[model samples]
Target: MTTRNIESTDAAGTVRVTWAAANARRLARQGLTAPVDGGPAAVTGAMVGAHAQVLSAAELSVALRLDGGATRESVRTALWEDGSLVKTFGPRGTVHLLPSADLPLWTGALSALPAGRNPLPQSVRMSGEETDQVVDAIADALADDDLTVDELTDEIVGRTGTWAGDRVLDAFQTKWPRWRQMTHTAAHRGALCFGPNRGRKVTYTNPHRLLPGFTPLAGPAALAGLVERHLYAYGPATPQHFAKWLATPVRWAAELFDRLAAEGRTERVEYEGGPAWVVAGDTDFPAERPAPGIRLLPYFDAFTIASQPRTRLFAGAAYERALAGGQAGNFPVLLIDGVVAGVWHQRRSGKWLDVTVEPLPGTLTAARRAELEEQVERTGEILQGTPRLTVGPVSVGAHA
Candidate 1:
């Protein structure tokens, strides 16, 4: 890719590009236009990380981007066997499968984030000193072996004081150990990550064990690097959008964007008539619009979550139909030529998978219907099942 702007207008040097051109570039960058020739790690890295809150969805997200006959098992192998991917807390404090090699960048940037307000009562909340002690104990407890939540709780209470074990923190219909509040913090500090499941229970282990000698790259430099990577995958984005994606304060994101612009590390542009920023040299939008096609994106897919200008991406009926309220990724989406135009669902039994697609009234032509069928078949291949397509109403609710 060239560093020079592809199409510029006026002496002010703002690159002019339409949403069509921008979407084409984004699809190519995200490995959505065609299957990329690489392993799960490369696809995960290109997209920053796959949203692993739903592990099956995350696996499908990566598998759908590969050129080879990659399956969900490919993603599992990378996480459990090859050690190329680490399951840890990522953007917005959600679970993500990040490339092991990029742990330094992720940990460094995430650890530097400004702390959010604690919802726990003062009596149950840990002080700064107490939080630090709990984080230390967590690191030490996971350094040698993987432990389930209950086992880890016991170890943590033993390592620290009884105060750390107080079951006062409110959780899903129950209370948890006060120290459990720092689970995401421990991961951000590069002290913890997911281990292979023992039976049906989840396990936690130290990231240092995954990648020997791993250490986070901290400070402003690391944050700047993260911004560049974000722009690479989803550029022409505003600080507000970046803040939303990272779950940070808009003011903080604006200050960082200003600093990056001042340092000549990022360039401001007029994207579809609105001001936005892209990496200084990454101003090359695709000259041609993306070809008309269909794709099935699973729930909580990274592309749907990270893409910006949501109003445009989810236009017309899509705004209300594909999205839950105003939040993206709650429902599986059907993409027509790169924008969400419908919704879909799948049910599996034995070796057969039934796929249902509900497209906007006139969105699907005969050719597009054929493409949708092919896409459904591809989805079945990734899931290791035989697919049967049904182009009708998808009556299920969000995330059902």
Candidate 2:
């Protein structure tokens, strides 16, 4: 079925919708309208994965979606103690919290991406054969035990060669071991994942140990499944949006979407003023207008990062205030109803948390102010603090 088959449209066959209605449907689908009754794993699955570049924010992202009063501690327990979630390099080669059960699909799809150009000089870069050796060595090294970076490097050098451990690659003002460049690749191949921290140091272990018998699904099928999941979570989106979200080439994403459409797994629809794709039979818009609610989503929250048609979602003053250089999620957003209306910042001291909100001029009403208070309280609860709200200029820089 396509948008043509849907009711209430213009003569052009486009299912024209208000931005509010579209955003409301997206919010409901993302478990933002109402908290879902499931644990962190379920919430993580729904989001595909929570961005974990900022671990605390990632925890809060999952906690906020849960029905039971879950906190950062709850998410931490799931990751380190309960083994329900796995920390690994996900889309865009950044750390993410993924459902441990779903690692196969993530690994397969991510590994299938066409290799990006290597920035490292040839003197430091490994040959394809050497890279494979390092990856296999990493898997073998972590198969039986977790290892810190230093320990893992030793194991890799012993298993492969001294060349693998040469500190030649420039990183932040220091040099990193040559083999370290393939860490994300190892994760995408289902061979490595984060281990519980040892003191203040991070460690790596084989994902097979985390999920016994874990094996990545074959690439083609896994990539198709990932596309379906993306459409479900952030649908009525364009191939360009998908390409950006996955850090893949637009040509690749466009071709994949075409294949899905050909197979009757997806359908094209007119969203905003452009063509977009959604999962077949999943194009129902909300009948009721959205309530004037407010939400304070943290930096790099999955919803803020993954949602499409940024121009519409970050409209008016939001385009200038909330975004950083045309990028979303650089600032914690103040979402009114569904679209971003403001930016927010949180500073914690002792047991008290100070939240500063800067909404677009004339956007906040008394009702919305009350909703903002409630959202601040919820944010405090998720962070285990007492919230103090300030409705004024948030004088903090992006990602502060």
* Candidate 2 residue pairs that clash: none
Q: Provide the RMSD of all predictions against the true structure, rounded to 1 decimal.
A: 1.7, 2.5
Q: Name the lDDT value of residue 198 in candidate 2.
A: 95
TM-score of each: 0.97, 0.94
Q: Which ranges of candidate 1 are over 4 A from the true structure?
A: 1-9
Q: Which prediction has the highest TM-score against the true structure?
A: 1
- Residue lDDT tens for model 2, 1-400: 1122245455744564445556676687678888866689988888889999888889888998887478899899999988999999999999999999999999999999988777877787788899899999999999999999999999999999999999998889998999999999999999899998899999999999889998899998899899999888887788898999988899988998899989989877777776788888777777665664777889898898888778888988799998999887889998887888888899999999999999899889986778788889889999999999998998999863
Q: Tell me, by lDDT, which candidate is best.
A: 1
Window of ten residues with lowest summed lDDT in model 2: 1-10
List model 1 lDDT by residue over 150-242, tens digit each.
Answer: 999898899889899989988889999988889999999998899999999999999999888978996698799999989888988899989
TM-score of 2: 0.94
